[model samples]
Target: MSDVLVAVETVSRAKQLKAATGALHEALDARMMGADLFSSRDRYALFLAMQRRLHAGIAPLYGEPALAALVPDLPGRAKLVEIDRDFADIGATPPADEPVFVDPKDVPAALGWLYVAEGSSLGAAFLLKAAEALGLSVEHGARHLAAHPEGRGLHWRRFTQALDAVELTEAEEARAEAAAVVAFRRVSRIAEETLAGA
Candidate 1:
């Protein structure tokens, strides 16, 4: 079990989409920040690829129970709900269908919410992993999305912590590294190949 996927195994395969997507996003954001500060596009692109790979990888989970829970069964409501919330929280609205990074100027703002969403997913997966490690399970019932609190709070907390660690001092930021980045890439690749083989 590759670490990337392993981190999310406690989550139902259906919910894996959310976890994977979130992990990939965090990896990307971390990479970007790392690159921006270190002046290393190599590092930036590495994380960027991770983010893209994760997005591509999680495409299958659109109908997974966990994801579906957040989205309404009605057409066009599920994905849009998050987008709406993001806009509402940020007090800025981009077109519903605008590309996420088409305009480089919006990168910072886009990344803010992207990181939050992704961080939440990462946190939830971390919680799920911890529970499983302790021999527990999350029974996400039908309508779980309704019951599942938004992960934004948890994600933002982690996000701010990361930012603080990095911004405070070089030594402090080193402590905040994503120990899981390399592991995630390895696992994600294996999972991709396995899925392709299947």
Candidate 2:
């Protein structure tokens, strides 16, 4: 029998999204590296401040019914609560204002934002380890970086499965890609602005 999948793009949505934003992601990673983000308590606080901005910016997206339909656990995926607690643990308050990028109801663009937000949890595992050196942990100043109760790999797989199953229109696909780029650029910009203020 002939294979039934020949027409489908073998590339997964997760991979396509990664490819779309890889360069921007790497540039931000390099900038974070050079920022000495974990070098000391002050630097770590600045890093957390930067994180506060990014996570707060997208915190609203997790609640959109359309987006939640895509990723069932989307509400539980929010890091703002943990980030807020981390700020408290560090004796700092996250600044009240954060720039909003996309409307939460814009499901396509929101997915792009979610791509960056959710994917960062994997990297957070490493950041959590680094936070340990600064006397931070899941219970302390690094709560946002703690692993999911379901485990990181499995959690990521669930998100990817949901992402991959989405069948977006050509126009929607373009929107998603543009939004992903915007999300990365926002992170880069926020990193610069946060560190500059530091």
What tens digits encode model 1's per-residue C-alpha lDDT throughout 56-171?
A: 33333343443333333312212334433433433333232323321222222222233333443444444344333433334321111121344546434544444332222333
Model 1 alpha-carbon drift over 4 Å, by segment: 1-38, 63-67, 70-151, 154-198
In the range 1-198, model 2's lDDT, one tens digit per residue, is: 987866765888789889999999999998998988888878998988888899889988988888889899999999999999999998986777686778998888999999998889977887888899999999999999999998999999999899888889989988998999999999999888888877
Could you estimate the TM-score for every candidate? Answer: 0.25, 0.94
| Cα lDDT computed for each candidate against the true fold | 0.34, 0.89
Ten contiguous residues minimizing lDDT sum, candidate 1: 139-148
- Using TM-score as the measure, the top candidate is 2
Q: Per model, state how many residue pairs clash.
A: 1, 0
